[model samples]
Target: MDHQPLVSLITVNYNGRAFLHGLLESLQACRYPHLEIILVDNASADDSVAFVRSHYPQVQIVENAQNYRFARGNNIGMARARGSIVGLINNDVVVDPDFLQPIVAAFAADAELGAVQPKVLDLQRPGYLEYAGACGGFLDRLGYPFLRGRLFDRVEPDLGQYDTPLQVFWGSGAALFLRKQALEQVGGLDEAFELHMEEIDLCWRLHLAGWRIAVLPESRIWHYGGGTLAQHHPQKFYWNFRNNLFLLIKNLSANRLWRVLPLRIVLDGLALLNELVRGKWRHAGFIARAYLWLLAHLPLLMARRAANRPWIARGAARTEALLYPGSIVWEYFLRGRRRFADLKYSQAFTRRLAYGRHLSPTQMEGVEQPYGTETV
Candidate 1:
């Protein structure tokens, strides 16, 4: 690879002309010299396509006739990417000019690194972290995902506590940095997910294939959470509930899946009950429908499992190393352990976490050296 490799930053826009100006201005200011911007317009009825063509003639545009949402839309852009490094940035984000530097450096340093995400702050409230992906993503044994600085609905302030870069389980789709070769090996994002949990699934596949995903705190970006799907929208709930199940079914090893899936079903039911009790009947209904959809589509889910098996067989298959063994739901709701640091992590996981700690300047420069496997 070149010292400053070509980075293809792909943003999928769906009637988000309002957010384009900030995104374009930030891209123009980016210090990276070999960057190319690709805008995949998901059949936006707005003047989004015309606006990009008029204002940013240098950007490559992929026009889709219908709204493909996140999974398929990003896959289309990834396919068209000419860079060794492919970036997935949401239209709702404004990136720091220097964000690409650390990302490029990290990728050059580590051959096994599949993806990297910047420190994501709230666009509306710059002092706080964003809910979508605060500082890279981690999942519990049951596949409940939470970030370093954000847990479920509770997002923490950016206190520099999570400033240390580390190997993470997943990179957020909102502002994802990926390696083109790794994506091709894993067959890109699962279009079936449509929107939610797709990034996590991709990262899981990468991990199984002997690649690492990471977070770079030195780089930062602000995200306007829920640009396409509002927090209160019933469709968001449906996708979140339904696709999360799909994620576990597709990626988790068979031995692990059989043990954890039954518990996940019960936990999901409790979530639905909580929604109903809170008088959010519509959200509750979406959860019920999500379950029904999953049950009706078992064959489809099974097909996905079969397709993903070859990668898992070839991979290190160390899923337990990155997974938090305790149930996040039990800790957050029942035990009131909201802060990431407050939880009592097992000694085994603490050692693994230590191995995944951020690289020092010296170590960063030396990352090109062969890396050994961590004990799972």
Candidate 2:
């Protein structure tokens, strides 16, 4: 697109020999031109090296000294990528033959576009969509994640409802294509986040810097969900819980955090309690450890906030967007709840603030919203 080799499809792999073969084969079979194929192996103990050497010698490869987690693997690929647009594809995905053409065209059409994600369906279940990038991701005020058509872990089956391409807060890293500028600005995925939510964090920083993200419904990919970690895997639980808390504290302002401290504590406590009741003792421990990890890393987060304050705070007073919720009520009830219409708040607040009318008194410091400032 635009006469440049616009896209570099980068795949990250770790011990997925069987899956990797299918991914590579599908990739080689794609019709899209002006693209380079890259594979980043995170020091797998399997015969991945020999397999690549035997079957896919033409593709560029990077072998890490040890197992680099998803974040690091992506970062390494980013550093090595030569194209202006980089496609961060998972080794477990099989994309359509013509997928890259429209994706590259999307970036060419919009200067503000930072990232675009494809609709990922289940490989085993055919038309069934995966939960990873359900109609693009959004953030509640307290750093909890929700999508336009999906929330929590409840995935909505594809009804062909999200067929129109629209701007979203973030893209799923699985089959995402991102502009190079945003990654350079945000400094790639935070190394602190080894696995989950790294793509969202990368897009959040991009948005904060005034970039945009979009979902291309026309482009499709089949994802073998839970390739690296199963749904209830302990490491998955740990990283998901830990990164949620870390990102919330790292991104929000001190004043906003103070305004909703009690509410956040109650919500987190409930989550911990639910885990305990369901006989998921380790899940509860992960939640507690997430808090403990964030508590210990508060100083580092504060230091980061101080440094980036100059970039966004240059001349702006307050940043606002639909993606940034005024309160958790918007998340819990107003979001995806058909019966929320008759609900009325007893106490009235000023203007359009959702649940700010009855804010908790024990709000913590530095808790501004973690919503991306980008338009898309």
Per-prediction tally of clashes: 0, 9
List runs of model 1 lying over 4 Å from the truth: 346-351, 354-376
TM-score of each: 0.93, 0.84
Give the per-residue lDDT digits (tens) of candidate 2, residues 273-335: 989999999889988888888788888877766765664453122322424454444535555
lDDT of 1 at 14: 98
lDDT of each candidate versus the true structure: 0.84, 0.70
Give the per-residue Cα lDDT of candidate 1 at 245. Answer: 90
